[model samples]
Target: MKRRALLSSLAAGSVAALAGCNERGNATTGTTTHDDSTRTTTPTTSDAPTPPDTGLADATTAVFETRDRTISLLGGRRRLPSGLVMRAWLSATATADHPARVTATLTNDTEYETTLRLDEVPPFDTTPHASPGRDYDHTLYLAPTERHGFATTVPAVARAESGGWYLDGPPDRWQPEAVELAPGETLVGEFAVVPERPDSFPPGRYAFGYTDDPLTLSAWQSSQPGPTEESAFEDATPPAFAEQSPAWYHDATPETQAFLRPSAERVDAPAAVEFTLHNHRTEPLSGNVYDWTLYKQVEDDWYHIAPWAIPVPLTPLAPGDTHTWTFHAFSGPSVECENAVALGHLGGGRYAFHVNMSSESGPTHAALFDIDAPAVSVTPTEDVSVEREYRLVRASTPDDGGDRATLVVQRTDDADTRLLPEQVMRPRNRGLRNTLPFFEDGVQKVRLRTTDGVVDDALHGGEPERVFRYDGNAFAAWRA
Candidate 1:
């Protein structure tokens, strides 16, 4: 009976903590211990039971920060016993207009590289809020004390069978990259302290501190490993050009054929383009129809502009089925800045629409559209001449062991066309069956309208199982 009772209490503790409740009492004097980062703060606590001592090394604290504009925590530095020096400060614009941000820096005094994952380190959490993944979850309320309490929640090291103990919330935008700092190298990351809601915190005193454990720190004992391996496409296929003006942009694999053409609307007006994918094979063809973007050509260069379709929460097309994505085409600097030149505000230009469609056979084929549209305004003196030939160059990387293929524009030399930074797909084993790219597939199917059951169940208190195969990059829906 005692064993059963203990198990019950353990389960209850996990549930209450997952619900965003700080199990420790509100800090009255202004110090609390954080198990997430394994550090202790001297904050005063109320008469509630104290949490277990984490036995972390001794650390000192200065005022991490407060609302007073007069003082600054920017240069304040502290050295941990582990030889990691930490520094934190507020941004210049932590005022009412902008959200509060805290920048934390760590310097490794030792000789090796350290792998620190930002997501695993629990930030100082505010309470009296909704669940973490919801829209209103950003509304963090203070504990009416000098120091905020530490959350026991840690990033789930592995996928949870249920949604009860998942670490990722929308606000935890910590880059999942392992921070590997070489000997004497410094690593810096920023965490947001204020909630998006203007009313989350009023003018007040709040002290924030972090835990001792740096997430996934890999100390360099010997010579550190080198940079990640990258390979270029070898044995690339030749450029496939579509028919002349009488036809639209067309390309095909044994299973599917894609056609891209401008809508009947005049080029001078608000423009739209039509993209269709047809399955030519007899068996049911299931390919992730999402993962698409658009780029436009101005003069001699191509720049990324817009998404061809609304990103997916939708379904893929069935065999003998078709999908279409239509949108007002745009063109601008590949990297948008406030002062960047405004090139094609009125629309009408050459565009390249690319989509990645993968199936059980691996990432098979992608669509590349090269189409010319009239300028935003057809001025009498403006010459609408297209000098360059627009073609889609489908290249199969022979070096990648046929695991991946890419679509690029066809340049004059039939060499691989230059692609914007956002255009490159980092090589990875994209063969995972459950991983479906869910960007706009152009076709708005009914199945895509459903919510992810895992997230839905987590927020709504329902049973969450493998209703859909979970993938970090794409959304996979439940199979009927």
Candidate 2:
């Protein structure tokens, strides 16, 4: 992305040649100053031919006359061949409370529609540097450096002080866009002049100027839209499991199957997987929380899958002791790392959980398993009776200080059932509302189950899931 380019043309002692001539045929000149006192010259009539009348209004008498202080136009407004007028102005005096301001406006005076490609409406200038000194009466005029684009010259009042004014830069994400103006339409922009240094800006006559590319008809017609920006994790790719695993674990030999193994060979996606590790060695085994890495097989290679919780220091397993561990599998990145890929939720695939033992000489162990597709299924049902199976129950009372409601999943059959975590619910075409799991279809029901017939209620506390019932009038919760 091309960030806003700074005003590189405002070098020391570089004067800005004012473009366009006023109605009186007087040309204005913008001189860059660094000294405490700046030299001023009277406006002189030029022999240059008069600029064509494009209905370009005089900014001084037209825009700034209402102000209490006097304001002068440097080169007057520039009227392009297409009748597009560009003008700028600055306040004559400034104080700490009301530092100063620069205003610029663009108007389309032609009968036909006009388009302009403006990266920035009012060009910004570099801060002026000059020490404060005795005030002196000096003439101030808004001058122009470049003809077409934003003005780049700092105002005379800003140049009169040791510390100049500060103006905010463009937003982090900005791009040039086409602005279409109908006949007689206008666009206005203002910049608040603030002192760069904490001290107040010395009171004095001030002038400002604008310089930018000319808004030509060719430039407007040829303008194309810029590329759109993507979010941080939008295009993230999953990282390889072996690349993220510890080098020591990859080099160690596989342990005997009896010491470490998964509870089942296959489990449903987006559900928890369980594993058992036995300390068969004569000594206790110790390791840290991050001693394990979970990987999912993609083709012949394995990619890393992030866990739900942060790793903690592991407790030492005494000889002949057994430890069981459970991990919730879902989609997305849990840990922040460079090139970290976020997998939304686990899909049907082969997976392996590798664990590293505390003993340096101990063999590493890996328990392989297969993740079946999520057991939840959604189908449309015309039967209104099915709606009674789901309800929206108030999870908290008003006295409890929380008025939140929860989705309650009622069992239509006698068989025991389990509801996967909210993260596991994936809607096909629309967003999934966790509290109101019901969708556009009035009787949409989801059947969720795990491989071992064990309910993992760690997240929902073994409570039946609840879903909202949207009636024609409004959404209401019903109890059966």
Candidate number of the best lDDT: 2
Cα lDDT tens digits for candidate 2, 1-480: 011011112111011222241211112123332331211221222211122221222222111111222222233356655578765543222332223334455677788877665543332223312221232222222222222122333222233233333322211211124456667665443333333333333333233323343211000000111112222223323334553332221222233212454556666545566666644332455665356666666555665443444567665554333466666554332233233322334556666777665444555555566667653233222221222344322221122333323223332333222222223332221112222344334543322221111122212234343232222212222221
lDDT of 2 at 214: 21
> Stretches of candidate 1 above 4 Å error?
1-248, 252-266, 284-290, 298-302, 308-314, 330-348, 362-480
Can you give the lDDT of residue 63 in candidate 1? 17
Q: How do the residues 1-480 of candidate 1 rate in per-residue lDDT, one tens digit apiece?
A: 342244334323422332223432211122222334432222221211222111221111111112322111211355655566655433222222222323344566777655554332322222212212233433432111111222332211111222111112333321322344455655433333433343333221232323343211111101111112221211223232232111123332222222322333224333344555433222223444565555555556555544323556434443223456554433322223242222233344445555444333533333333334333321111111112222211112123232222211111212233322222221111111112222223311112111233123222233221222121122222222
TM-score of 1: 0.22
Lowest lDDT sum, 10 consecutive residues, model 2, at 216-225
What's the lDDT for residue 456 in model 1? 35
C-alpha positional error of residue 320 in candidate 2 after TM-score superposition, expressed in Å:
0.8
